[model samples]
Target: MNNRRLPSLTPEQCGSRILDAKCIVAFTGAGISTAAGIPDFRGPNGLYTTGKYNADKVFEIDYFHKHPEMFYEFSRDFIQILKKIQPTITHRFLARLESEDLLTGVITQNIDTLHHRAGSINIAEVHGSYWSASCLSCNQFIKNGATLDWWEEQMTQSPRSPVVLCPHCGGIIKPDVVFFGEPVRDLDKAETMIKSCDLLLVLGSSLTVYPAALLPQLTSASTIVVNQGDVMISFRQDMYFILSDLDAFFKKVIDFIDS
Candidate 1:
């Protein structure tokens, strides 16, 4: 839902701003991971449209409590998808910016952890990630380092066994990801970063989600949105919108910066 009466910017202009900025923060969403074979939430091939996966039951807390299997089934496929993909060009561009000290940090709604894998040091996962999980019964914690092995063991442990369960109390293991009715993770920190940055880069997000969507309003930082479609918010000043393929846009941006 875009109201296109606001001012627009070219890739070179946006790159010039980025090169001049002291602190550049990136805000990303599922669109960043779509090229990595991860489906967008409302996109055509997203979980909502797929007959095999029900978005309501997969993310709804009440539904999860009653039928956790539905979520685990989705998770199993999601984890497999992650295995087959690497970070996209956009992901690498942000990571390279971070490495060159041009980027302050990243604030992301994606749970893929692609930013982390791409070598971004500072990040805020507004929606929690699958990197870590905890036991619901005994509050037993599973560290990120152990997550993959643990997930693998459970999947092959038995055919009738639960997809994910606590080894200690046989309790269900819940990933740190935000479910429906759950508050976003690290909101306070994310807001602080957003407010402090000199530039806010919106990448691959529809900006339809609440609380997280309100972040841009909390800052007067120059905003640059690079995605394929419309974004919900339209700023009056210091804003730029580039509606194009993320990778192609970023390639142009990188060229502008290096030149």
Candidate 2:
């Protein structure tokens, strides 16, 4: 990650521009949730710290079928972390923008449902969420937090074993999160939002992940990126970059919006 900081406009300037825009779209990532006490699974002190579950192996559909316990372990920790946290100021601000009609929609790389909890009506989660699950055998879907708790219970009792047998047909049960080989969710909706947006705001993302990473490029709107470091994107003259802590920057923006 590049440690170099990019020049940023004043909070008032950024907020004014966002407020005045007819249609705004936000692309977000894990960084936006860090302030709410969730760890970035790809960051230094994240899952890499333990060196146990390989990202490639753990997220693969085939591997998950053979070793559902591994995914369950990770999910247990994640579910607990999410339960203890609330949406941060940045998330609330984005929701507020949506409520005021300043923002058209949000395209998020995050699987957490913080944006929805914060009252944002229009959201496109490129990555699927843990809030739901699917059964491979019966093709039935369940949407509830209790399902995650049940999965955790199964994991504790059957560690090092696969417990993916579907309830209806004894096949497999998978969390709704997009696995390594799985296609992202809502590709068409994401494309439509990007193409129709008048302004695009990118927050707290490295933009390394493909498909979702390329959504910003599809927009003809002016882009404003607020992240801690450099991301892979062709620099356009209309793009405004802000390299800083997302929570701090957004706090200032919220203040300006309120004023």
Candidate 3:
């Protein structure tokens, strides 16, 4: 998976570069979670390309406000899939990198909470996550919102799948995930992490979605982009792209690190 526009690096080379760097930050997206049964937006079998899961309705803020049920139906399935899956090898690799102090933190575009599940402590969930929900009508009035277990139980209750509601106000409950129209959650912290890091690993992201996409461009750090398919970002002298499977590629990196 070499791109004609720029030179590509092997997983071992990537590993060597990572080990040489003092500060490292990883930017992840749905591609990293696809191995854990979550679908990415641009992949052939992804949510947007597949006939299932209407991208426009599932993520659009205005559509959710008008017909929240559509989003709920999508969520019902998403949560069900999420409950049965485990974090992928790529997820564990990042977690291990952080635990060993070789990596700074993870800045993720995924709302799946896989990074947290993998035991990465310092994570900036740029897209927000399903792990927390707020009362839409009350405008996050509940200081401590319902736990994830509560949210799951409510979202999956039988008879007819219902939109999760805020227990306090009986208003619709919205997962903290940033919708298409909403601003992403943690740009400031993600920027700080990226700007200060000596190396940036762009994993499983298309780099098409702004301003998360824009974050990588802001830093002059050595950047590596790894994804199976085509990405939007162009190649630069300090930047490298490895067009390969996320888990397979990371497996080599981790193996090299141990050796």
Among residues 3 or more apart in sequence or in different chains, the pairs in candidate 3 whose N, CA or C atoms overlap within 3 Å are none
Q: Give the worst 10-residue stretch by lDDT in candidate 3.
A: 141-150
Candidate ranking under lDDT, highest first, comes to 3, 1, 2
Give the per-residue lDDT of model 3 (tens digit) for 1-259: 2343666899889999998988899999878988887755566865567767678679899989988887887776677667788999999998988998989999999988888888888888888887677888987644333344555778666336368776677788888889989989889999999999999999998888888888887788899989988778766668888888999999999889899
Best by lDDT: 3
lDDT of each: 0.81, 0.79, 0.83
Per-residue alpha-carbon lDDT of model 2 for 113-141, expressed as tens digits?
A: 88877788788888987656788668887
Candidate 2's error at 6, in angstroms?
7.6
Clash pairs (backbone) in predicted model 2:
none
Q: Which stretches of candidate 3 lie over 4 Å from their true place?
A: 1-4, 40-55, 141-148, 156-161
Ranking by TM-score: 1, 3, 2
Q: For model 2, how big is the CA root-mean-square deviation?
A: 3.3
Reference-based TM-score of each model? 0.89, 0.86, 0.86
Q: Which residue runs does candidate 1 get wrong by more than 4 Å?
A: 1-3, 40-50, 145-150, 158-160
- Residue range 153-193, candidate 1, lDDT tens digits: 67778458655777788888888888988889989888998
For model 2, the stretches where C-alpha displacement exceeds 4 angstroms are: 1-7, 42-45, 51-55, 144-167
